[model samples]
Target: MPGPVPAPPAAGPREVLALAVPALGALVVEPLFLLTDTAIVGALGTESLAGLGVASAVLSTLVGLFVVLAYGTTASVARRLGAGELRRALAVGVDGCWLALGTGLVVAVVGALATPTVVAAFGVADGVAAEARTYLAVSMAGVPAMLLVLAATGVLRGLQDTRTPLVVAAVGFTWNAVLSLVLVHGPGPLPALGIAGSAWGTVVAQSTMALWLVVLVVRGARRHDAPLRPHGAGVLAAARGGVPLLLRTVTLRGALLATVAVAATTGAPSLAAHQVVFTCWTFGAFALDALAIAAQALTGRSLGAGDAEGTRATTRLMVRWGVGGGAVLGGLVAAASPVLPWLFSDSADVRAGITAGLLVVGATAPLAGYVFVLDGVLIGAGDGAYLARAGVLALLAYAPLLAVVPLAGLRGTVGLVLLWVAFAGGYMAARAVTLGLRARSDGWLVLGAG
Candidate 1:
């Protein structure tokens, strides 16, 4: 046999940047909606701001859990595109959209009906709970639109296009901020709808974005002669494919939740500091994920083209990029840690706690980089089973480290630093070990466009 298909021509910086830059834009823009909502809703009153916080948390959880719609679809569609099965890729992506629609609708119904219960569960004051219920009720209207955006975005990413989603997200963000400002306060003839107006503004903005994406996908389907109607088997398969990734997500989320719980025991100052550091960490994660997203699409495409060596080479390149990117992020955070706390808090104790926590975060950034890239590569390989299993194992590894916090009576700044050490150091290292081992092996490199 001819020498195993020469590693698909070297995947250089150009290839990586093409996908990563737009991905970074889309990823970073996502959180701005919540930030805008907070700003607009804050001006209403304390009760309204509190309610928005609770409601926004619920919405974020819902959307985060369904991210598999994007990741799974990206892997599936990219593989087919790599296989030169353009029509089939489009058809698969359509099925994912259908599945997203069906799932979103059901979630919207259940979420809307349970708004009062969900709000009550948060245990807020009567006024806050009432506001939460109202905001969540209206916000439920946007859940389907949000899911549609996720799935459709995945479809485009799989098609090796990221710029479109970035554009749509930018426009949606602008519209949401403007409409929310006007509707929440009723700038002109429009009646002030209070917190509910903020919800509506977001809903309308999300729906418009969803519509735009659907139209684009529909146009692609038409050009490729792909089926738009939901096929029972195809839709079911998409759902099934997403399940493993869902499990993976759930476990990872569980780990984060556990970390939060541990942080809660360290006193109010520590908790406050932890929150700020965690938020910063999350922002950094979004930046790192941009490279991972590129790795996902490219890895899938390479494997679909049956170029295993190419996939391996490309993965190594991404790993390098991940390390470099992470080191830079870590350096920036370390440099800024002294001043960053002033922006978030004026309390000396809280600032001290944040500074301690951030130092640990800075030290571990390279490890996180290594872990995140392999994660994307595996996800691109559609190796969710291993990822799901590994996620649980990594969680298990971190649990004992976290347990030491309470046992050791770590408190205040000490507690926060210990927590970050366990999190960014212990937990991330566990993830790195599991993901690193998998990447070094050929087990996840299943070639062909199945």
Candidate 2:
């Protein structure tokens, strides 16, 4: 009953921006939730903020490790759509949602149970550990919602619809900001819950976002006559497909966790400053990832339509855009380095540490841009196995850089600066080399409706 597949369109700046802009909006707004939490929690003093940093590192690792849900689903659905299988594309999306639900449930239970032990692994101060425990425990409730949002966002993106996610993200961010402010500070009749309040607020916002997105996906499925009931086989298949991406994610998270661990050794001021700088770095990276997101959808669609040449041309164009975007972001980050630390802390030591890290972040933004775009393009092409392998190589390349900070007895602002150097500079460059090599080859130019 399906119509013939239409020819894929030319890859151009207009096409790229059409998707990238909205994706950028959604990506930017997503991190503002964390920024809001950081600012609110920072007000409770350095210990609370430091605890937040530790807890966030753990939670981020857990959540980020599962990002295959979104990336895998996007490529799968986009391929189906390109092959002229609308109903099948929607069906794949549904399976991804189910897979995300099951995984989130298991992770939340295991994570909640293991919270104290995991927090202890960081070996932070008692005050920081206590806050970390409280925040991580409450935050587990939202893991399912966060994952559901990821799968749902992937679904819309595969459908070439980024605007809806942007709107949803905006609404969720506003809700989180207001709720976190009131609950953390205890305005009106509300009792102040401190860091726990930030956790609760984020949970509520993430839940709302999940429900809204699921409803939209469900409606779309119904219109396309896609199955609403869970298919065990399909769910299992989706899980299997995600394995390589999961591996890739583990390598990525491993790098981040290693960096965070080293930062913890640099003392509370350095650790807190690392947290703020890392947050900003993540914010900037995700902003650059807008191009990558567009790359994923476009590359998947092109390959699905058997447009290898178009895929190659589009990739070249996007890479240039990525470098340009990175340069602009680096400039903004550098410009704000002077005043940015003031928003997060009042301590002179923490501010000094933060300034040092931001400089490294500014200097290395272009490499991040180049790496992120290629990473997305490959994901869209469903080249997860190669990505997984390259990720390990990149991690191996970064091990030496990360090891030197603590081994060499670097401390204070100097230690923090080198830590960012290991990550934003050394680690990013390694990624660029690996990804760039892959992009130059024609092997990833797989052509098919798959």
Candidate 3:
């Protein structure tokens, strides 16, 4: 009898799990950190909640603006790894570190000057104004630490070293939790600073994580010349290479800030409640985002290894995994929504608002997860222009909805976010489909195998 046809190559569960393992804790801890911040501050009073929400919004907009370094660094590193140019990748990574630090310093100075104005623009009460300014000031102090960790971690992720970042994040969160309890509540010798203490605690936590990354990358370089270090020539070229990603992030930031503005304009209660729901939703997104990071690094490195087949297999498998993960988390969140609000706030209205919005977030989890994974694959392939266009399209779709927010109420604001997820997912899916077709035409991919 003739032998059976050979089975097609595909990524095993083990491989996918290995790639996605690093982001697992961050998926849990980051959202937990946000909740901790909200809970700790909310205990102080409603003004504290209002202040923290506005401050967090400003911080998100600021950080969101510079995500280019991350998107670019990952793809750049992945491309170099694919080309077997480890040294070049390290050089670009180092340059990115310096760029982020310098930019962060400028932001620190400017952010300090702009705090009052930004808080004012939010239109919060005089009673909450002091709390907002205090939160913003403390959070701004942590910018350098936060930027360092993000930039350095992005470079290492390109090299597929997710473990180190995970360790750093764990350490950061541990310090954050400990410091928050001691400082915010005035336990031991620490004076109780309330909401301000939570803000300061964040800075300290981020600093610890940033230092951890520095130590890891430095030690890695000392051992055998890590490609993530700076080099002479790629400095200028590397910065330029990050531009498209920067543009993509800038456009995306605009969308996010606009959303926050819409929510804020509705009233303080809407902002506070949004701050809570968005924080929970992010936990799910970031958890699944680890898969995207895995997919991006795998695709880039696989391509570098001259295994186009490997890249296609990895991307397809990752997308499926991401969607599945999202669905599971959404279900869990929906089921747990009954008890989640008690952890964040005691206000009946705020609790009800957060619970109501989470239902919508839960329903759309799978589609949103696809968007997150596709973004990772594209970023890994250095396709920021494509991402930028999609974001612009999504924003355009959202513009008209802005007028409808007041009428539809708080739930309407959350619904718009769901729509944003749909547009984003569609954009990424189109790109992935295009890439798959091209890979087939080039004879690097086999359809029947999948």
Model 2 TM-score, 2 decimals: 0.86
Candidate 2, run of 10 with poorest lDDT:
1-10
TM-score for all predictions?
A: 0.97, 0.86, 0.78
Native-to-model Cα distance after best TM-score fit, residue 383 in candidate 3, in Å: 1.0
Whole-model Cα lDDT of every candidate shown, in order: 0.91, 0.89, 0.69
Q: Model 2, stretches more than 4 Å misplaced?
A: 1-7, 38-54, 122-134, 178-198, 263-277, 334-359, 404-422
Q: How much lDDT does candidate 2 score?
A: 0.89
**What's model 3's overall lDDT?**
0.69
Tens digits of per-residue lDDT for model 3, 1-450: 001121122456676677588767654665567678888888899998898888887887766677666667776665565566665566666777777777688888899999999899978899788899999988888898788877788788777667777777778887898888777889767689988899989999988888877666555554546555455456666567667667777766666567666677556655677777777776676777788887777666666556667677777787788789889988998898788888988887777767776776777677777777777777777666656665566566556655466556644335444433433344334444544444345332212111
Model 1: how far is 141 from its true place, Å?
A: 1.1
Compare the candidates by lDDT and give the number of the best one: 1
Per-residue lDDT tens digits of candidate 2, residues 378-431?
Answer: 999899999999999999999999999999998899999988988998998998
**lDDT per residue, candidate 1, 1-450, as tens digits?**
001122243478888998899999999999999999999999999999999989988998988899999999999988887878778888999999999999999999999999988988989999999889999999888999999999999999888888999999999999999999998999768799999999999999999999999999989888878898988998999999899999999988899999999999999999999999999999999989999999888998888899888888999999999999999999999999999999999999999999888888888999999898999999989999999999999999999999998888888998889899999999999999999999999899888889
Arrange candidates, best lDDT first. Answer: 1, 2, 3
Candidate 3 stretches with Cα past 4 Å from truth are 1-11, 42-49, 185-196, 226-233, 256-280, 330-363, 398-450
Which pairs of residues collide in candidate 3?
82-304, 90-227, 90-228, 90-229
- Least lDDT summed over 10 consecutive residues: which range in candidate 1? 1-10
Tell me how many clashing residue pairs each candidate has.
Answer: 0, 0, 4
